[model samples]
Target: MVNLTDLLTDLAAESADVDSLVAPLSAGDWASPTPAPGWTIGHQIAHLAWTDHVALLAATDVDAFFASVTTAPDPARLVDVGAEEFLAPPDELLPRWRAGRAALAAALAAAPPGEKLPWYGTGMSPASMVTARIMETWAHGEDVADALGVTRPATARLRHVAYLGFRTLRHSFAAHGREVPTAPVRVELAAPDGATWSYGPEDAADRVTGPARDFCLLVTQRRHRADLALTATGPVADAWLDVAQAFAGPPGAGREPLSTRDTTVSEVTA
Candidate 1:
């Protein structure tokens, strides 16, 4: 059984990891552009805070959360709009994000058992919600790390991200307007501590094998498949690498490979 407490704890640690990255930054660093097009470090945190607040609403007040969805100015640009609306000076935005994530943790912990929290186009259990939070935190943290030219070691927290990525395979295909593959795809990843993390069937013909970090990067759309050392066997697995996405939204224009990029920083479609 999935343990909410464990997932929540990992979520806290993931948030703290990102917080540590930003907390030491000077005011000017907050404006540093990340890999995400048009999004600064500040915008990344703002987006996290905004999403946490919205998630908190989903957990505690379903009506209000849905109301915000219906009233959004631009559904397509909702993520950008949320980040923009919550963007602030470092001192202010930092605290806001910290408090919001903490509150979201508390709210998710106290949610009724098996209750599904309404999200963008679907609903999620509190555990799943927290897992998604961890995934997003790691992904955006990657952006922040890239902006600062810092290398973050892969941790066990990547398990949550990898799992979410594997689970969202169908959503990825649907988001790209492609027919979802019916074949099972096995994912075998080498974890950070030299352990293996396997998902899907043991005998599945379609399989993806690689370092866990690379798979997470691919699913989060943080890096292109060509940049990663992942091996995909079978046609379904091969096609998946091109369109894989762990996020809930339209197909993201992912980053270009290093050799193809005009500048040092890889350009990603907003």
Candidate 2:
């Protein structure tokens, strides 16, 4: 099993790094168009901060948490919580967002081992929460980086992302009403620091081999799977390309096939 503490810590560190890069930008930069349709950089960060707040609440009170949430907030009541919180001037916004993140971290750290916290579809243990949050932060951060035309430094935590992707493979197939492959596929991922992570049966009929970061990027739709040096052999391997999800919830409407050279991000806007 993966260490939840390490996952959460890595996510917090990456969030801080992204925040630092974003903080020095001018107001106009906040509204710059990102690959995510209709969401500016400000909106992305705001959503993260808000999600951290919500997760903290769920960790504390699972029942009451779901009772309070709606598909959409009452627009007439607070149409711009994210924007208002993000634009409260840098001095105000940064500290508050950081504080919220700290609170979330604290909640996760203090939770009893094996404690299940309520989430959107199913409840998750503190361990799973770390995975979910890391995936979200990384995926959204990709959007911000894409908008800025900058590349993020690779990190070893991408193994966590790949793990999430591995878990979502079943959901991806089920969403398309296709049979989930019973034939296991071996995955050997090379981490950023030269650590090799391998999963699945060695003698399985299929295999996916590549850098861990690239595999994570592919499943998260931050980079085209074909753009990486990964090799997928056999029918099951090809099926994975048709429906791969890294995040929680239902499988996504997978993207159209792109040429091997397309590295542009293909995430759906929220």
Candidate 3:
């Protein structure tokens, strides 16, 4: 089982970073549309805050959480649910989100050992669940940051997101309604600071190789595989590259290739 201590700490820091970005925005700013079609900055954050609240429920009240999530519309259609329900301006909306995220983090940090939490897709241990939240936090945070025309620094926090992407390769395939190979595919990434991170077996016949940044972007669907510097040596690895997703839900409409620039954002709604 993954020890959630460090992961939770990282998650809290990531949340704070995103908060800092959105906190200074004006009411008009939150209302601005993002790279995601039909979703304003407010809608992006509202989705995070709403999911945060539900994550807290998964940690503390599993049955109640299931009931509410089941009664709500499909996750895909719920983007504007929180923004619509809160019915407040940016100042009010931001505060509620801050409170909810803080509470959710605290609850996850304190969850009992070995307890599995039910999520929209698979059941997750505390660390996996929090890591997933951090992944979304960073990914959605990217969308909001792009909408604001702001560039944020990337950190080792991306390692967790990358790990999730590698670990969830099977789920990603299944979500696409495709079967995944049982064999493991090796993943080797060059970290920004010149560290090497490896996943799967070092000697595995199938391998994915490249910078961790590009790998993270690929898994998050922020960049299309063709736009990244990744190389896959086997069929499974090659196919996985075409449809990698670190987030939950059905298959995502991953970002399309733009120019050769890696810094630009993709309009993928996933």
The residue-by-residue lDDT of candidate 1 on 1-270, one tens digit each, is 899999999999999999999999999999999887788999989989999999999999899998989999888888889999999999999999999999999999999769988998788999999999999999989988988999899999999999999999999999999999999999999999999999999999999999999999999988889989999999999999999999887888888886788423553322
Q: Which stretches of candidate 2 lie over 4 Å from their true place?
A: 70-93, 253-266
Identify the leading candidate in terms of TM-score: 1
Name the top lDDT candidate. Answer: 1
lDDT of each: 0.91, 0.74, 0.82
What total of clashing residue pairs does each candidate reach? Answer: 0, 0, 0
TM-score per candidate: 0.97, 0.85, 0.91
By lDDT, the better pick of 2 and 3 is 3
lDDT of 2 by residue, 1-270 (tens): 667677778988878778877898887887787665456777777777777887898999776677656634653323245444455544566677789888998899899878889876677888888888888788878878878989888887677788888777776677658898788878888889998888888888788888887788778866656566778999998779666777655555433345732334344522
Q: Tally clashing residue pairs in candidate 2.
A: 0
Clashing pairs in 1: none
- lDDT score, candidate 1, position 29: 92
Q: Report the lDDT of model 1 for residue 67.
A: 92
